[model samples]
Target: MGQLMGFLNIERKNQKERSPLERVNDWNEYKEAMTEEGARKQAARCMDCGTPYCQVGVTLNRGTSGCPIHNLIPEWNDLVYRGLWKEAYERLAKTNNFPEFTSKACPAPCEGSCTAGFVSDPVSIKSIERAIIDRAFDEGWVVPKPPLRRTGKKVAVIGSGPAGLACADQLNKIGHQVTVFERSDRPGGLLMYGIPSMKIEKDVVDRRIRLLEEEGVTFKTGVDVGKDITAAELKKSFDAVVLCTGAVKHRELPIEGRDLQGIAPAMDYLTASNRHLLYNEPLESDLDACGKRVIVIGGGDTGEDCVATAIRQGCKSVVQFGKHGRLPDRRTEGNPWPEHPNVFSVDYAYEEAEELFGKDPREYYVETDKFTGDENGHVTGLTTGSFKKIEDGRAEQKKWDADLVLIAIGFRGAEDRLFGDFDIEKDPSGRVILADERSYQTSREGIFAAGDARRGATLIVWAIEEGRKAAASVDLYLDGKHSLLKS
Candidate 1:
């Protein structure tokens, strides 16, 4: 409550974004940072309600009501209001390990639940968060702080995505030696590869990875776990093993022509695109979207990334087929404040596509029937159908022009290779089965699973939460009841 009536006296000042026309021309972040003074005023708008639902950290109606990581929102907001930037950064770090990543990538359910947003605009929580963390780095406040002492324990964390990275970070802080294994050439799994550079430029991910290394977390890349290192070996070598392997098995559109030369999974296309951008790899037709007719299936983050990628590649046309019809502009009665509202808003990719193509690439209520290809066997076009209702099974079918197709529907579960080789029991959907009513441990003792691999594909913040929780569990398993980490 830096300013008791600050919310009433001062109108909200949101951070402005770079023009879409200018941003899409390169692979870089588009949003501009808000000023320190502006952030303080915005912080003054925090009402600091007794409940403070912006950090409620609960799930309802299949959506997040507030920040999943339970970020100390009001604390930092008040600190910023008092011009205590360093204090704000310290408060921010207490909850979130990577505000920079989340600020750029998260949908900000915290803002959705803001008291001010119930009437007018919400507190600029996301931008203010980004400002605090970015300034922390710029001021050299973010430096390596190796643990005070060693616990004489070792933990092997599989996968280098957010969950793995977060788990490694927590374990290291508690003085447990941690090593993260990644199959790819780079360390960050989704953060470095799955997400496009336009949303969060590569260097941001790299900066964090470098810091993690400096803090004593070992990163081993280009080493497949199940193949190069066996589960038996990990269990024998390390005191405990935490599996942070994300749910990466993509749900496929296995219709006819799926085997065509140009048809590939969303990850393959995205990974290839990311590799090209980060490593300067040669791009082939299937991997490149430049000047080709591009059609993306599924309308989630992956699909949006494909649309953004295609636009940046100078594709002839971009079309996204969303199985569900276009969402309402405003939240429906079913989606009240504090819950993640199911409403329509343009993302960075959508804005870029709109500016470049003169129309939004999304075709709602559309479903793919089958893909039709040219005589040469390379993908050329596909068939589609419309859905009158999301529950409706049938609609009018038609053919659409497409040279490249990216399927971004969603993930099924973890890949069969890594977990399956452990001889671990699996759920009906192939996810590693947990032990008992509440457990991160699997049928195999000393082995624990967290994040998407356990709960299926979820938000990034949720992944970080799972990692922290699992790391605590792993510490308990290692150091018994005397350990400081939460069980």
Candidate 2:
């Protein structure tokens, strides 16, 4: 480390964010860049523990703790502390294919497991990572590096989300001819549309896509695999096929009056908002949240995004409902250090809503009972109830106004249409194209799966790891030897 006792000398510092009042009025990112000196100081706070649990990506007792991709955290932190920007970036890129995206959107499990966080604040790892990548981009060090030799093996990756893109990038780097198929108009799947523009700007995604294209990866956008091109054709044409479609089917609240108008899914709403931002097009009929009293039914990231978007679209008002009670401000008993603490958090969207609405928009311990509709069958309001889990594991509901209801209760699994079309065997969870950890090969010979479609809706870091592992498996399957793809 550059400063052996820097942690004792300096307090932790992070990037300043735009004030709630100022940032809510625009769609730009709320976080302001920290100066290079400030970033170095923050990096110096890394205690660099003996075990370094932050980089030990593993789950114990069904609880996940550290970075899923197992990033070289302390190495890069030391490099950053030493003002070795390029070296820091190199160490970061060694494991993470898209540090910029993960830095912006990941929940920062690494920080949660940081040794410094056992007593005091954790090092600002995400902010330092973002700074390193942004500096790399600014210095023109981030550029296309095509493989020196071509393996002449073709690989088809379905879905261009983080997992699929990471798989394609890894395979292409190893000199395999890789092509990515995306159903949307753009290359990035969830990163392009499901996420709001304010959190991670679309330009960041586009910039990386451009670089991948320059590196000779082919992208076929607006092409549905099963519909436009059959799975049989893909299997026959490409040396291998990797499914990374992601878990996208939104779980619905199937209570009475669910058929009423003005009730939509969270992905639909986010997709429409992003489309409007990207293409200047009118909002889709089933997706707009404008000029209505909106009630978001879930307190996760998607629900927070709904609150922010409704406020931006001039909704009459917005509120979020969570079935679980509000989490404690700090870690609780049995939730010790190095585990991802289930502590309360105020995200950027919540801050925006608080500034605009004069209060936090979240209502915890609440569950939707039913929806109320107007004469024209439009959603007028909703009936909700306070839920409490009893000793016997039953929910006791106690009945609250919902005019527009959004079911952001998360996804169950990936859509089954493509899996069925390909005759791919699924796991008990109905996830597509099952494969063992060792082989990453499907029930069928050359087919494979990775990312959410293979696992479930997980962190981007996990997706990248799966992609790299799947690439190695595919390489070994093709050439009878495994390459340096992190498997």
Candidate 3:
């Protein structure tokens, strides 16, 4: 530890943000980064706990309890506290291929597992991480480091989301000729389109993509691997193919008026708005939530993002309904510290809504029975029934009032076309079935599936870990039994 008893002396002060009212006017990231001294002080709050649970990366109670990538949390914290920004950045980059993405988007299970949180506030791990990486970039330390020699083996990575990008980055670093295929007009499958710019700016994604390109990773955008170029042709051309297409088949809300004009999947609505903000494209007529009474179903991160998006788009009102009743504000008897704390806190969108609308826009234990529409068949309102939470934790019914509805319950699985085209078998959930748990190989040889495509939808850190492990597996598969790749 950089300073003994620093945790007792210092307090946790995170990166500041622009006020909710001031930030909603534009689509830029509202975070105001701290100075070096401020970040160092925050880093000093890391307690020197032997066997620190923050970096254990264990699955406790069906969720990750710590950093999934097993990042050297203490090492970087110590380095940052010592004012060694370069050393901190190096330690962070060693485990995380994309700290910029994870630091911004990850829910930070590491904080949940922090020992400090048992008594008082947890260490500001996420803020310190962002500070380290942002400093590295500003100091021109983050540069393109292409491999010295090529392995003479070519690999094709399908999709340009975090998983695909991490896989491509790793394979390229290890001397493989990697070409990433993206179906969208721009690269970054989810980072560019699925997520809003306010959470993570477009330029941040573009800068990382540029670095990947400069490091000899080829990117082919606007090329659908399974559609334009058949999977058979791709298999013949590349030595190996890794599928990180992501779990994107949004779960549909089936009921009466399911086909209403004003109801759309959360991803489709987000993508349309993202494109409009990024490329000056016209937003789809049905996708816009401007001046509409928006209703978002599901209380996950996607639903929260949609709430923020609709608010930014000038929605008349917004309400988010969660099937499960509200979680306890503090940990319950079954949920304790050092495990992934399942406590509830008001998230960003809800806070912003509170600031704007005088109260949190949330409903608990509610179910939307059906959508109601006018003669034109457009969604005007929804019927819901409210139920009291009991032993079974089921929803009965609730009331609803909405003009635009976003079904953000969750994703079912990956798109079936790519896997089907490649003759890869899918599990019952529609995810590409892996050959073995250790290796990310699919049902077919010379092919692999990682991230959400192999496992169900997971965290970005887990996705990166999968991509890294899958890259090692692909390297071994190409180089034979005695392959020296890191597995």
Candidate 4:
């Protein structure tokens, strides 16, 4: 470690955030960068544990424990502490192809497992990571470095989300020709659309896309792979195909008046907001929450984001419903240290809601029974319920007023249409292009699956990890040699 006693000497410092009152007025990134000295001090707090559990990516109890990408957390922290900014960026980029996205959006699992977090706060790992990458860009240290030679093998990667981008970047680095296909006008799948602009700016995604293009990864936008192009065509045109399409099928809340005009899916709402913010065009539909009493069903990051977005859009009022009971602030006995704790958190959105509404908007242990609508077929209110767990069962019944209902209950699986058209075999979950953990190969020969399409909807870091692993498998399938993408 740089100072050895740095953890004792220095205090943890995180990125400054915009004031809730002011930041909620518009859509923009909330967190401000910490000063260089502050970032260094935070980096110095890394104790450099003997094992470094923060980088030990694995599954515990069927969930990701540490960083799925197995990022070299302590290594980069040491590099930052030593003022080796470029080297820190190199080590950071070696594992994560897109730190900008994860630094901004990921729920930091590494921090949860941090050795320092057991005694005090974690070493501000996420903030230090953001600083390292931003400094790298400012110093002009990041540049396009195409592979020296071409392998003459071409690969078509479906979907331009995090997983697909990471896969393309890795394959391109190893001298394989990579082309990413996106159905939307933009290249970044969820990063470009599903997420609100307030969290992650679209320019950041565009900048990375530009870098990938410079690095010889081609991007084809507005091209539906299974529709405009066929699976058989891709198989014939390219040596291998990798499905990186994310789990985007929004879960529906089917109840009375569910077909009301004013009710919409959370993705549809967020996507419209993003498109309007990014492209200055009107939303495809009039789905704004403005002036309406917005009721966001399901309490997750997505629902919280809806609260934030609705506030910014000047909604009359906003409320979030959670079927689960409120969690404790600290980890319980079942979830001990080194495991990502299932604890209650007040995210930026919640803070903004509290500041604006004079109270937290979340209502826990509640479920929607039915949607109440006016004669014009527009959502007017909602029938709600409180749940109580009985012996081997659960029970509920209640009601409330909700003019605009946004269901944010998360996704079920990837759209089967894309896979069905290709005749790709799927799991019982109806997820695209089945494959094994080790090989990541699909039922169809020379085809592979990774990320959300292979697994399920997960974090950005997991998607990146899957992309790297799948690229290795694809490389091995194409040529008898192993891929250098392995961490």
Using TM-score as the measure, the top candidate is 4
Error of 1 at 373 (Å): 1.3
After superposition, the stretches of candidate 2 with alpha carbons farther than 4 Å from their true spots are 61-63, 389-400
TM-score of 4: 0.97
Clashing pairs in 3: 384-398, 385-397, 385-398, 386-397, 386-398
390-474 in candidate 1: lDDT tens per residue?
4665668789988898888898888777656777777765564453224478788888888888778887888887787788788
- lDDT of every model, 2 decimals: 0.85, 0.85, 0.86, 0.87
Report the C-alpha lDDT of model 4 over 1-487, residue by residue, as the tens digit.
6468676677777899999998988788999977778888899899888998888877776656778888999999999988899999999998999999999988888988888888877788999999998998999998999999999999999999999999999999999999999999999988989888788899999999999999999999999988899988998999999999899888999998899988889998998888888778785434787787899999988898888888888888899999788889899998887888788888898888888888889998786788887888888888776764443376666667777889999888888786676677887666555788788888777889888888898888888998999999999988889867565
Instruction: Compute the lDDT for candidate 4.
Output: 0.87
TM-score of each: 0.96, 0.96, 0.96, 0.97
lDDT against true structure, model 1: 0.85
For candidate 1, the per-residue lDDT at 16 reads 79
* Candidate 4 Cα outliers beyond 4 Å, as residue runs: 284-286, 389-397
User: Better model by TM-score, 3 or 4?
Assistant: 4
